[model samples]
Target: MNTRPLLEVEDLRVSFPGTTGEVEAVRGIGFSLGREKLGLVGESGSGKTMTGRAILGLVPPPGRVTARRLAFEGRDILGLDAAGLRRLRGARIAMVLQDPKYALNPVMTVGRQIAEAHRAHGRASGREAERKALELLSAVRLRDPERVARAYPHQLSGGMGQRVMIAMMLAPEPALLIADEPTSALDVTVRTQVLAILDELVTARGMGLLFISHDLNLVASFCDRVMVMYAGRILETCRADALSQAQHPYTRGLLASLPRLDRPAETLPVLARDPRWLDDARADA
Candidate 1:
């Protein structure tokens, strides 16, 4: 087994040029991902998705992304040009965006979409691509894979849409999968099903997973490790089992804010904000 990390990011920074000045969205965050599930938990504006986008070189114009080290499968992605990044995006590292409604093409059949993704990285005939697409759909637990493949995105529910997205992402058999809130838009039942599909796929394929979301409890239960971010910086990083025992106040507050069925608090406590949590501790250390 290749024991080295599939994805490594160190001292990553993303800044946007605003009228007032520069606004740093990702202020020097570092973490590594192997062939295991890693969760990034934080509130909005914490740079979770931005960090994933930066990994794929998806940051929009006027936003600058810089990193001391950014590598995937031992290849340095930091300096990769557009063509190189495109090859790496779906072939080496695939991403599942938050909503499939926006991610999928309305006019294209689900099978065509997945087939296109497969063909993007390698050569495949139409029949071969369709066969692979149906197999991918089946892998994600989609019922009646052939029918689902022929259906359009609008014909499917949110959960099914997400499943199609997952199938497409998995079609190329990428080494790393970055899922940014892949289930956030679905209902509780659908969300669990979608997450389970993702978990099973990652485990079965031994692919590295970067699950980005603001739900701390989900992260705690689902991921091997959890990274808590605040104001574009990591507040704490610890094993999933140790999340409740996290040392940082910010992480503790986040865990406390979640509604727990076992504890059954009358009212969940509000998270207290602290500017000091965003300070660069690496410099002081």
Candidate 2:
């Protein structure tokens, strides 16, 4: 078995210039990833999304990103030039954003977009790209992929659009995928199906997945490992199966707030916060 990590981040931090001073969006968080599904769970503004963006060097301008060591396959990603980072983005590491309606092109056909993605990576010719696109559409379990490919993005349902996003991201067969809430917009029933498709593809390809979401219940069940974030830092890291036994007060508070179907509570508890969780960054659980 290959023991080396696919990606390793050490002391990663992102901050933006504010009126008062620098606002730390991601505060010195670090982790390593192999070919496994890892979930980052936290409430909004907890810096989960910013952490994902930083990996791909997608942190917007005016915001600065710094790390002690941001290496992918043992090479320093932080040192890569624009050209090198561009090559790595879709070809080696891809991101599937929350909504396809915003991510996909408004003018391009879904087939053209997929083909373009493949061609951008120098993976195939126009003809072969289109063929591959059709194949991927089917792989995502889209019905009548030929017809769907010819259609525009607006024509597809929310679920179908997300599948299209997945198909596009998978076109390059990247080593790692950063999915930032790819299913939040879909319906409850469709959410399961989309997750099933994503899970199946990621497992078959042996790709590392960094799934970022706010739903603790979904992350507990869907991911192999889970990291609980609060105020720009990971407070706990534990096996998804063992989330119920997580020792951190923040993790426990999150679990307690969830509505249990097995034993329904009269009222869901509100999360009580502590100031020390932000000040002290424990190494790990």
Candidate 3:
């Protein structure tokens, strides 16, 4: 039984060079993920997705991802070349984007797209890949697996499309899964179902899960641990159960802003803006 973490990121910084100057999207974020599901919760520009993309080496040109230490399953990923990163992307680590519409190809059948992902990671052949794809769809609790496979992205509803994306991501059986707002586009009922599927898969496979979202209540309930970020810096890291009792000002502010079910107010609390929240010097040290 290896006790080491599956992924460890330390002092990660992602910056983009612009005409005006440089924009630092991620500023020295650090965390370790093991078999448990971890949530990164923040606002839209909080750099949660950027951190996930940096791990996959998906940062586009003009943006540089630098880290003192970035390891996946005990291997240094920061130094991996394009080929190495590609090999690692779907094989050892996989990502489920926020929207399946953009992630999936319009021209390709859902089954073929999943099969291509499997083949890219050296998984199986044509027949075997189709079988595996159906199995994956079934795992995600999708009905009519064969029919769904033959359908295109446009043919499926938002929830179904997301399930298809999940199936494709899980086909490779990666050790780590990064789901960026995986259920954001779905309705409440479908979102619950999709999250349940993800929860079961992670627990059954003992895989590390990086679940990123802006919904604090969802993250608090779903993830084992939670990392609250603001302006690319981690404000607090605590157990999910302790989220309501968070001590950081930013964390408290976020909680205050969330709509309460039992205690309804005429208006939701306004989020206060503080310059110190974005100060990396104070956040890091």
TM-score of each: 0.96, 0.97, 0.96
lDDT of 1 by residue, 10-74 (tens): 89999999999999999998888988889998899989989999999999988999999988888
**lDDT, residue 37, candidate 3:** 92
The top-ranked prediction according to TM-score is 2
What are the lDDT scores of the predictions, listed in order?
0.88, 0.91, 0.90
Error of 3 at 88 (Å): 0.2
lDDT winner: 2
Lowest summed lDDT window (length 10), candidate 3: 276-285
| lDDT pick, better of 1 and 3 | 3
Q: Poorest 10 consecutive residues of model 1 by lDDT? A: 276-285
lDDT of 3 by residue, 212-248 (tens): 9999999999999999988989988889989999888
Ranking by lDDT: 2, 3, 1
